[model samples]
Target: MHDPAAPDPNDRDYPALMAPGARDLDALDARLVDCRACPRLVEWREEVGRVRRAAFRDETYWARPVPGFGPADAPLAVIGLAPAAHGGNRTGRLFTGDPTSDFLFAALHAAGLAALPHSRSRDDGQRLYGTRLVSPVHCVPPDNRPSPAERDNCRPWMARELDLLGPALRAAVVLGGFGWQALMPVLTAAGYAVPRPRPVFGHGAHTRIEGPDGPLDLIGCYHPSPRNTSTKRLTPAMATEVFRHAARLAGAGR
Candidate 1:
């Protein structure tokens, strides 16, 4: 049972409790790492940290909320659904130490965005140039699915991140339908004029949303999960092309 004195995750103002004075990404991230708002997520993350996956049994698990990776003032952002259970949840960095990262970072490197072709650990010497990676949900969910309430509970973090990134963020490549849907509202709330009826999600789909400073380009791409790649629904070449397009839109391309 949750302590009666503990803050309620369901409360609409729950985010305030996490970081009331956070005026920058670093402060926000520090607060995010300490969040224990959702009991289910908190329990699951810690359990995974303790119960050791066979391949990673010798390694210590980060087992906490994963934060966005890359420079604070990046021009382009790659938005994903959530952290992979054994990937980001273990490494404490988005898209690290998993097959999904293997596919995605290789593509990012091909597009001149990432310094390394693979993301395996927090200290992997990997770097992103003018690009940042973020997600709607920071924690890994059971079966890779976060409930609606959990999504909502985590929305504020994304919103705050976007708010801080607004000055430099010019374009975004959203991976999968879930990220596309989740980001639309956040964009709208961030002062972007998302189209009425909203744009549909599809691979290579592109739209320009007018923001207070200028237009922010949105591009859709298939998630780089093994399932999609194995089925040929998304290929390395396809993912690379999407990042290249987003880079050009954000003026970050080589």
Candidate 2:
């Protein structure tokens, strides 16, 4: 039953809604999945789901915000720009069912972070060890570009997720410049002391931010997008080394 007079949850302030919570990661994830704070994103994601791509016309799309994936106490975090419109936005899991996942997971497996070399679907028995995959924006934006407003609207979810991860999250591998820029502020908000000028984003770039518990290492890596990989801007060896470096920094083993 629908209540016509009820205030729409989508219209509520998201950051405020998440502020008073003392819940665990599961609770946070539950709330995150139902968010429709951005009208443009809400309309776009749903529209894509309804129309769908030719190959997936018969399949159901997740259509909602995608949640972070991995164990609650993962020592390493892998941050990306956002869910792919036809990938995570359709598969219900970040970095699943796309060329990006194919390239990234294979690298992760080689670095001893993931159990499998591919992440095709949510229930495919794929697993990550001592690592979690998250993105700055949960909803897939049009043309794979999210507006600054949309990015800000989505910040609270990532902030809360990182807060819940807490001291256990020792290191992060940020893929691409967009994610690198987006994550800096989130790290600062999570109580890490970011540098005055802010560190620049470059492949193989590394910095350490002092957190309440200890120093957290940040490593930059080229996004494993089809464009980058196909052009050889980022090679398999380069990607694997970045993950391996982050794993070592986080003290995570296979």
Candidate 3:
């Protein structure tokens, strides 16, 4: 069923696959939009776009990979699991147009990292002062779960993101266990030495790893999913506390 003459979207060589002269943030985003490495993710994202969710019937879904949000040189970063089907997949921005985003922005605002307390669309004018948000997998996976192979396949993108962020990246707040697990290796590959026993993820877990730039502080926070929030697994205060600590570590006082 595969066409031999066509270019493979899963091509492993990043530099060769990217457009000529595509070196900046906008160019990197364009390259991300063209990724179709995972067959299942590609089909599901496109199908979700075509069918459209009931509430978003009048709106067009992004349907493609969602790139990291905020400036490339931000001092702190928040890493999430993956794009939500009706959230990032709909707004083309991480944590936008969803209840999870509402909770997240509120916490970030309280931590003094965000200018606003909500994000509805990409053009909402909400801005992050010293933070960025990215995901381990860029695509909206089926059933909100990406296969192990899929996550590994997307590592190159994450690696490039970490590289672009450069030495300015001082602290990272990992949301939930998935983000924690996904980021450990990325950090290790980026020349950071992970702990010997490996750090466990908890609501307010914290660890320090040596990064290419300098000592990178890693903080953990439970994801603000509806299930977690409704059940009180992840409270607003708890999430805000983790970010506040991260801000302090990054020397970006709130």
1 versus 2: better TM-score goes to:
2
Candidate 3 ranges with C-alpha deviation above 4 Å: 1-7, 10-22
Query: On TM-score, who's better, 1 or 3?
Result: 1
Number of the top-ranking candidate, with TM-score as the measure: 2
Candidate 1 on 74-143: residue-level lDDT in tens? 9999999988878999998999999999999999999999999999999989999999898998888888
lDDT by residue (170-247, candidate 2, tens digit) is: 999999999998998887877789999999999999999999989999999999999999999999999999999999
Error of 3 at 232 (Å): 0.4
Q: After superposition, how far is residue 69 of candidate 2 from its true place, in Å?
A: 0.3
Give the alpha carbon lDDT tens digit for every residue of 56-175 in model 3.
999999999999898878889899999888899999999999999999999999999998999899999999977989888999999888999888888777777777878888999999
Weakest lDDT window of 10 consecutive positions for candidate 3: 12-21
Clashes of each: 0, 0, 0
CA RMSD of each candidate after superposition: 2.7, 1.9, 3.1
Report how far off residue 112 is in candidate 2 (Å): 0.5
CA lDDT of each candidate? 0.88, 0.89, 0.85
